[model samples]
Target: MKSIKFTVILIFMMSLTTFHAQEVVVVDSTGVAQENNEVLTTSIVKDTIKVPFKRFKAEGVTAVVGDYVVLDSDIDKSYLELQQQGIGVEDITRCQLLGKLLEDKLYAHHAKQDSIVVSEAEITSQVDQQIQYMVSELGSEDKVAKYYRKDNIAELKTELYTVNRTLKLASEMQRAVIEKVEVTPEETSQFFYSIPEEDRPVFSAEVEVAQIVIEPEVNEEARQGVIERLNSIREDIVDNGSSFATKAVLYSKDGTAQKGGLIEGIQRNSPLAKEFKDQAFSLLEGEVSEPFETEFGFHILTVDKIRGQEVDVRHIILFPELSQDVIDAARAEIDDLREKIVNGEITFEEAAKKYSDETETKNNGGQLVNPVTGDTRFDLTKMDPTLSAQVYNLENGEVSKVYNDRDYTGKSKFKILTVTNKYDEHKADYAKDYEKIKALALKEKQIREIEIWQDKKIKETYVNVNEDYLDCDFSSNWIKK
Candidate 1:
């Protein structure tokens, strides 16, 4: 139990750790190229467990968790994955990796027993996205197949579907186990204090920032120019018998341009701007639509195919130009607002509510929340580089000069930021860091729930450890004999 406890704790910590996003090459013992793997996850269990099966040769079954078999190669591949993820696996033995794999298989096996259904469409969509990403990265579908050692794209997709389905099942089962678990304020306080004074987590310097953004106004001429450009593109496809994809390659501005502006499996409720979806759904097969304006830019769409409630479509986006005068006016407007706040004539939050153009943050008084942590405070060490550079030297309540920036869609905007609050590096405090502590407590509670669920499920299920792994110190008892 002590060994198993260590394994579980390590797994939990690793699950919380973020991994590097760079591409990783997976090789064999002799350094021969086997597969090109991506950093699908920085975690230990689910994402890291996705082993490229291109040239994999199984070393026979090492254990049986209900209906699922754990092959010896699974442990080997997991070790390689951890190493590639920059996790030091020297201290992490095969027995431990196997233990994790067994746990995953057990979860997946019972997910079926518990009637947790992972939709085939969802799994297929995930596979398609994965393949598409790989193709874009590796340059071609053939290259992607070769990188994975698949004979063809079809083989790669088939293998990927199996891998994705199993992962989804395991994930769903784990979610089912711990979904209801929660931590109370008392539990959070207890968890924080239970740690020895010398061992409590240290927090880095953090700041809460607020901002007001102003986008340059587009003149009628610029708007009409973009609309006319899109109309011309639509005409070329509909009238001149030109290829929409070729036109997208020659003219579109969005990231999807490389894929000929293709967007797949778009439901009516997809996160695209409402106007874009409205135009998309209105178009008949092969019928190109007139230009439509969305927040990103102007677009003209053609529905390549429609199946049920989903549409497979292609479209091109073109951003209207902002005149220098309008751009200067936007900067001047924000600059004036900043001066008023600094002179105490208007509060920053008050000005933000009345004038900021960013809808997401404006209602919150322009308070920028950390998207990752759902908190207003951002740790300096982990802050976005561009944002850190902007506010690094700011004192509490000090407003920054107007700065130029681009939104996610690359639309230019002018903004001024203020560090509303700043905290120097310090040891964790109960009241000061209540939210962080509560999150930690909740995660610990969830881990315990998963462990408890595994214990009960392992006993009821017919789990068999091969003689080779019989000596493994698994947290859950899998060796019934």
Candidate 2:
């Protein structure tokens, strides 16, 4: 048999706690030996000597769980792949690897016994995403192919499909084990109090700022030009068998272009613009949408697949190019509004309500919310680069000078920011940091629940590890002889 290597690593990250495990299996090629028997032909002329033959010696199993056997070469291959991905092998003990392998086998065994099924489309999509991620990380598809010893992306996808499907099933099983876990308010509070004072995390200096953003309006000609370009691209895709994904990589302005314009696992009821969502969900699989306008820009999308309410799609987005005159007009308007606010002719909130083009913030009087914490507070260091630089020295209630910046979608806008509130760095407190503490507590509880489930499953499953790995330090029980 030809030797092959495989490696698997599962990582879980939580605040103050993380788990990392790696499994490697290396298989050795089978070897055949032949022995020839020589008889004393001079002494026995009538007798013929019979020779016995020996069969090839097969490679030893690296790990075993029930009917599953992990070969050594698979382990070695896994380690090599992990090294290519920049994961260090020096710290991972052989026993740890063996334990992880046993755990994976156990999960796979149980998954099969439970009749857990993963769809082919899901596996294909996940493989594509994994390939895209590796390509991006390794700098190019050719590099990825070389690293994986594959001829191309298609061969790599075929190789990884089974692995991706197994991992998905394991993840689903883990979620099932922990889905019903809940942390009560008392438990959360207690978990918070258990942290020693000196060990408590320190909060960073934070600021709450508000803004009135005014996007420069493109001229009719510019808008029509963008729309026509998108239409032509769409036509090329439909008529010429041109790859929408390849075109998206070349032409899409969005950050996901590196991923072939794929936006994975977006819910149908997501907070995306209504027009965009409607058009996105209305397309059939492999169907491309015509040019459609949203708050961001004109977009053309092809639905790759849909699972329930979640959709995966590739899109090409084009934004209308604005001229200096259009931008100057927006700047002048924002400057006028800022002057009115500074002169007390209109309150900052009132001006924002009346003129801000951004609907999410305008209705709320332009108050900025931290997407992470879902609050109107942000660590000054965490603020948008442009906004932070503009408001760095501005005192509370001070209005910044008008400045041009791009919004989340990379659309140019002019804005005047005001630092409404600032909080000095301090130690975490039960009152101010309740939400943060509760989230940490919930994560801890989930981790604990998963651990408990894992322990129980290990006891119920058949696990066996080679004696060679017995002396290595292992994090789990995989040596049940």
> TM-score for all predictions?
0.85, 0.68
Which 10 consecutive residues of model 2 have the lowest summed lDDT?
13-22
Residue 374 in model 1: shift from native, Å? 1.2
lDDT of 2 by residue, 361-450 (tens): 998889998987898888887777866788889999899988777766677888888988888899988898777778778767776665
Which one is best on TM-score? 1
Which tens-of-lDDT digit does each residue in 1-481 have in candidate 1?
A: 1223655565454322311122432322112235454222222332232333344354577888787877766666666667767888646766777777777778789999989977665667667667776777889999887876678889878876776666667777877887889899889988999888888888999999999999898889999988888888888788899999999988999877887988887888788899988988888999888888887888889999989888889999899987889988998999889889999999999999999999999999999999999999999999999999999999999999888998756778999999999999999899998999899888888877877887888889988788866766666677864
Residue 402 in candidate 1 has what lDDT?
88
What lDDT is obtained when candidate 1 is compared to the true structure?
0.78
Worst 10 residues of 1 by lDDT: 24-33
Q: What lDDT does candidate 2 reach at residue 177?
A: 62
- Give the winner by lDDT: 1
TM-score of model number 1: 0.85
Q: Report every candidate's CA lDDT.
A: 0.78, 0.69
